[model samples]
Target: MADTGELKQLPLKSLHEAAGAKFGGFAGWSMPLTYPAGVMKEHLHCRDAAGLFDISHMKLFAVSGPGAAAALARACPIDPRALPIGQAKYTFFLDENGGILDDLIVTRTGEERFIVVANAGNADADEAQLRAVASAFDCTVEPLDRVFLALQGPAAAQVAADAGIDGADLVFMQGKETDDGWFISRSGYTGEDGFEIALPAGVARAVAERLIGDERVEWVGLAARDSLRLEAGLCLHGQDITSETNPVDAGLLWAIPKGLRSGGDFIGASALEKAISDGPARKRVGLKPEGRQPVRAGAALVDGDGNAVGMVTSGGFGPSFGSPVAMGYVSVEAKEKPILAEVRGNRLPLQIHPLPFQPHRQRKG
Candidate 1:
């Protein structure tokens, strides 16, 4: 068994236990794996209605200085110089070899201040990298170990609207502050309309209670979180991406800005440029299993001749789709046709399909 003492607790630790959550150690935190409703039910609930997730374990940091944007550009692949205030962009922290260290959301708050949200598992490394670069410039990086919540689903917009959130004005990848020291972003892991609210520990708990007070909202856990992200075609930090995977190979080439392509002197630009021009040896893709049994991560993919071509990174029984779905890398040659996954020592047929197994019905209208 994993050592419980080594696991960290979020601000809502007791509340999760009170709700009868099944716990698991994720990124050193004692996170809820699932609730009584189970992963399937919670996954469906988030797709159809609103589901509240305690995402407080994610690392929130603020970097401020006269040259903050330029300093950030030195560390990330995105062109922070062009990022408008109140806007956020999903980008990656590239290593010296052009491989991803972590994927993050960066928001420009002021002329000299920006807010960066990193993955919970890579928070320490991300902070260290940021500090190492920031030291050269006259900037201060402050890590906020606060609470965050993601309220996501088709009904998420309505819930936030009812709470006087003016969600219509907040477009995707945009953020605004509420009266209670809360930062609300119209972004989420599920392919649905939602908001990620970051606030102080005390106020975050209160906000969660208020949102859950509504009949439409239900508490979701990590199990559902994984399935939802898979259905949404989003990549998990350690699973879909790692220091071994480049942005291009992970199917995130769009994240590389045009300015950064040629003249941009960011870290790993040369390798990334080479990969962009030559193309990666293998690319990430989606798969739909033929049977009810889910194709889990590490499951091997074989070609028609039974040659190992790839492996599954994330997979599960998609509750919304009513079948098994998966996402992973495949050889460039295998991209044109159907592939098979080796599960339980048997070759199971799988069809290559487009990502986002489920459609996102956000509040765009």
Candidate 2:
């Protein structure tokens, strides 16, 4: 655990404190780990109604200028130039070795401007990498000082409508800019029909208060957020996907359009092409441990004969699914073999389940 004293605070720290939030250190930020309702209740609440989350710790950046899209394309595997206005595409920043540096969402706001949302832990490094990639192009990477919020669940749309934020028409992966300083996206990590809103820090508190004041919306903390996203099969950067994980092995090749698969001038293109041709040594997969015991990360996975196969990266109980869930990487040959996770000096049987323990309810139209 990181020292809370040394962690940076969120802009809404006071608001969270007033709401009975328990603070913890995550990615150098003092963030709310759980609210009064607790992780289980909060997780279930989000699935049933609306759950509001303070995700201001994530880094927001505006990359604009005449060459913005072209330059961004050099850094990411996706072609930002192809992104239509008001649409966002999930993508990754890969190193020269084809390893993922960070996973981010890029929203095309204008012909030459885009908004990037990156993980807090990799914000600084991602910004530096973006600047370097845009150096030769007519682009400028400017960090935004704003408060980001996610309102997610089955009733999220109705809640947003009641809160005076009109997101009723925005389909999944779409975004719209309001005149009131709100950049709203119809997307979330929780695999629910939701909206991620970015607004000025000055108005964040009042806005949060108004939303939570609604009977349908509850304050959800990071702990429940992780469980929610895990159930949705979203990858956390430092854990499921990392500096050592490639798109092919991580099952993220879908992010790359078919047109860019054969060739592109992007970084790691050759390496990624080679990886696709030769196939990855290890592939990320979902694991369902037998029994009710949780199989945590760093636990070694083995074959039926106890041969080393892989290791768990992310693991915990899926509150919505009501079972233990995990994700890990395994050698291609061993991925199909019977697997077991070593927990507390005991080997536990595990089944290879499909990704996303919970069904995604994101709005399609």
Candidate 3:
């Protein structure tokens, strides 16, 4: 949705078209908004079976050198040096003021090699910041252009097996490079168990065709992806989180290890430490509106006296949950009863429900 300057197409554009995709602009890419099955059906199908998505718009970077881990630690809060080979960790890049610059997945492929996957909107800035820090550590940051596909759902493992891809040994947050140049990881935006495959563009179409050939697999688009992630209580970088949001207030402290919280040295350590000690002024919480009407993002959260307390970041109708779910930031003092959301100039009754309207069925083992 950002500017859409000369939209770029993914490698599987033709395949999506064949699947009856309705295209729309997102982060300067002409991506599919939905297929013939629509967002509701696609969202439910993924929960029951498998949903294949083209997430190639995300940026991938290869950081390798003896100082790769050190370089990443300086830029991000996580201690990459402690990351085991073939393991991946979700973390964030922070500005000096402790605000999150972006959230990313860092996979340690080797002793001195890692693959950093960042959001598309922040790619340019991420690459620049990484390069600036990498140079000081004698590390090299190389941008990679490849096809990124996510196959997610309850039956995703069987579908991958049907395609002759051996990922049964991998659990959540684990990835390994195949002999044929494919990076298969047991991770996804959806809470369901699945694998994300990154491979060369030359064989992308063939691989997608092979996967979708199964009866259980269906092509999904951005619309369903957003709803699915919302149901899973996952945060979208630019929307739910931004450069103005810090890890503590955003409820992302779990992503940062305790060691880092106590004594770690990183870009935003001081600010984060202070926030932890002082406590967050506002905390991210789940909102359950009373009616069937979906509460979209940017809706203001107010108190009984109609005073603005917080704002909704991600909100929508969850297909699997069968209810309108939303997540937003609320002031700590205003985290009281009778929280209302202003809809069409009318304050509607809502409750502070726990996050993740649905349970995460991730294959942790």
Candidate 4:
């Protein structure tokens, strides 16, 4: 166990305390688990209104130099050369054996520069990998220990517009640097309209204050964030994907560029190509529990005969769906019938459903 007091703090730490936030240690940071209104209220708030989240613990980095994009392409499966400026793509960093090191978001900023955002827990490992790649390619990698904020919900666009930022013009996976010295991206974990803002550490506090000043916006915590992402069918690193899993089995084959499917060579390209040609043995699927009981991660997913076929990776009550939902990897053979999840030593009936449990309300423009 880690020491609670020794955990790192975010720029909005004081604000969280002032708002009576319940604290929890997450990814080596002391983060708010929920506010005074509680996790349920915060979860619903993001679905109906706007919810502000302190994502400062996420790692941000910038890669630059003449061959930055090409050099990064060698490690990542995405075709960076085709990614336009101001546009971002969800991709994976793969090991030599084709296992996923981490799934990341990479945005092309210029011919020679790009911005990368990665999970908080794997920040050091990601940085080390990038540094090694840069050294080999003779490029430059700079880590930005900045503050990041995610404003998510159906009313997120209106709130951002009220704050003098026009989110309607920003399409999904697109980002722009605002005059207020913040980089705003039309991306979020929740299946709703939102933006992730990256700003300097010094201005993070003010930005949070300004956004929360709006009556439509409330401060949310990690507890609701997890539920929102799970409802959205978004994969959580180390849980849904890891060094042992390949992208094809994770149901993220669309992320692989068309050109790379054949000739474009990159790290783990051969294995990924083979997996694409020959289907994976198992696949990720969503589960709708028959009763009100919520299944949990690591629970055994069994067939009617009581044979274990898969394991739940993420599971919870989907606030948007108003039911118990889960995601897990099941063998392709077991996908034909209604599966059963072993919850608390009882066989709970479950319907194998498609992903994105809640419909996405993100703006198309």
Question: Largest lDDT belongs to which candidate?
Answer: 2
Candidate 1, which ten residues in sequence have the lowest lDDT sum? 175-184
Candidate 4, residue 113: CA error in Å? 1.0
- lDDT scores for all predictions? 0.86, 0.92, 0.91, 0.86
**What is candidate 2's CA lDDT for residue 101?**
98
> Which of the predicted structures, 2 or 3, would earn the higher TM-score when compared with the native?
2
TM-score, every prediction: 0.96, 0.98, 0.97, 0.96
Tens digits of lDDT, candidate 2, 1-365: 55798899999898999999999999889999999999999999999999999999999888999999999889899888788899999998999988999999999988898889999999999999999999989999999888999999999999999888888889999986666667889999999999999999888888899999999999999999999998888999999999898999999999988877766878988888888988888988989998999999899999999999999999999999999999999898997789999999999999988998899999997
Ranked candidates (lDDT, high to low): 2, 3, 4, 1
The digit string of per-residue lDDT tens for model 4 on 11-86 reads 7788999999988899899999999998888999999999999998899888888879878888688878788888
Clashes of each: 0, 0, 2, 0
Best by TM-score: 2
Query: Per-residue lDDT for 1-365 in model 3, tens only?
Result: 34445899888888888889989898878899999999999999999999999999999998999999999999888999889999999999998788999999999989998999999989999999999989899789999888999999999999999898879999999988766767888999999999999999998888899999999999999999999999999999988899888989999999998999965768888988888888999998989899998887999999999888999999999999899999999999999857999989888788888878889999996
For candidate 1, write residues 309-345 as lDDT tens digits: 9999998878888899999999998877668999898
Model 1: residues >4 Å from true position, as ranges?
1-3, 164-168, 178-180
Residue 120 displacement in candidate 1 (angstroms): 0.7
